[model samples]
Target: MIRKTMTVLALAASLGAAVGFGALPAFAQTAKATVDAGKAAGTVGEQADGFLAVVSGGDAAQRAAVVEINTGRAAVYKDTAAKTGVTAEAAGQATAKQLYARLAPGQYWKPLDGGWAKK
Candidate 1:
């Protein structure tokens, strides 16, 4: 019984390793997919820093909303990456500012208009 158990354990370990090794290529493919998505999106990393910049001016509520938007973008990136075999993260990092610029303008505060005003 002891010997049988040992053999079974060894087999399981080997199988796990094999499965893990097999996953590496898939992971690499996922990265490529993300890049493709970024290109297709035409706005990968744009959200993070842009969201941060806008959040700085708004109230706490605004900050939370911006964070939610950024998180949503990341989730999309992950899904796209998983499907296409490109690295969306890398693409986002590479041209975040450019991407942000391309993005539609977000909330803007106008003091004279009378909402919030400036501190």
Candidate 2:
């Protein structure tokens, strides 16, 4: 079951990475860097709800970066949902599952189990 789920998530991330989520293109360089650092430091984590969240309190700048990334994700989710005949929340949830698998080791993720763990 775990292997199957991982395979599915990997495929989803690959496809979404190409044309859907647009996390790479949508996030600004500075915001992306901030998010990267946050993830590495365990200060922020990728949420199962398709948004970034602070695992540990961070400065206003870090919070702002999360907002910026989430805004881009929101637009992408809306567009994808419209094209796929799904709700934005559904699309976002699917994308979140995909993105969660993309997190590197030591980065934090909120899994479908509803708990945070290092990837």
Candidate 3:
């Protein structure tokens, strides 16, 4: 169990670095502002699957932003999984750890086995 935890942590670190360095696609970057706004408004949140979710019934714009951002994240996770010899789902879950750590106070987020909660 410890070994597995360590491995996941390492992968999270690597994925975080890639994301922090602006590795997301241009479409994701373009939608980031809207996503941020949604988060602040409690309409959007990060999921344990390394993608954004609409916590509330968000407007069309917010939902669109989430879709755009998630699409980019899916591509990044797939690429990282290939490079690191892990499954894409594993890569995404690892990245989700890093993402959860960065959540600001009052932002909503959901765990894999639970409902949404405020950070």
Candidate 4:
């Protein structure tokens, strides 16, 4: 079961990296600048579940941007999950791995079972 799940996750991650995260929805694109700025400023980070998170000291605008981005991501993850036969959570985690690989230096990320860490 574990092996099968891992295999599915690997396939899902590949698909997400190749297409899912690479192509943001129109709504997400609109908020991308805000999230990118927040990330550069150390106020926002990508979480292990394929969503943006406010690490610290985020204002209302940044919070709103996070919500917008996450909502878009949830939609994408759900679609990907349906196509890939995995749970939406699993699809998000797969995408998260791809996102983590693309993180820049000085950025923060939180693992599924750990506190935030800088890369």
**Model 1 error, position 22 (Å):** 37
Descending-lDDT candidate ranking: 3, 4, 2, 1
Please name the candidate that would achieve the greatest TM-score relative to the true structure: 3
Residue-level lDDT for 19 in candidate 1: 20
Worst 10 residues of 2 by lDDT: 18-27
CA lDDT of every candidate: 0.36, 0.73, 0.82, 0.80
Per-residue accuracy of model 1 over 37-83 as CA lDDT, tens digit each: 44233322223222222413344444444455455445544444354
Q: For residues 13-115, write the lDDT of model 3, one tens digit per residue.
A: 7777565335556766657888988989999999898889999989998899888878777887888777767778888888998898998999998999999
lDDT of 4 at 19: 35
TM-score of each: 0.36, 0.76, 0.83, 0.81
| Cα shift from native, residue 62, model 3 (Å) | 0.9
Superposed on all Cα atoms, the candidates' RMSDs to the truth, in angstroms, are 18.4, 5.1, 2.5, 2.7
Name the better of 1 and 2 by lDDT.
2
The number of the candidate with the highest lDDT is: 3
Which scores greater on lDDT, model 3 or model 4? 3
TM-score of 4: 0.81
Quote the lDDT for 58 in model 3. 91
lDDT of 2: 0.73
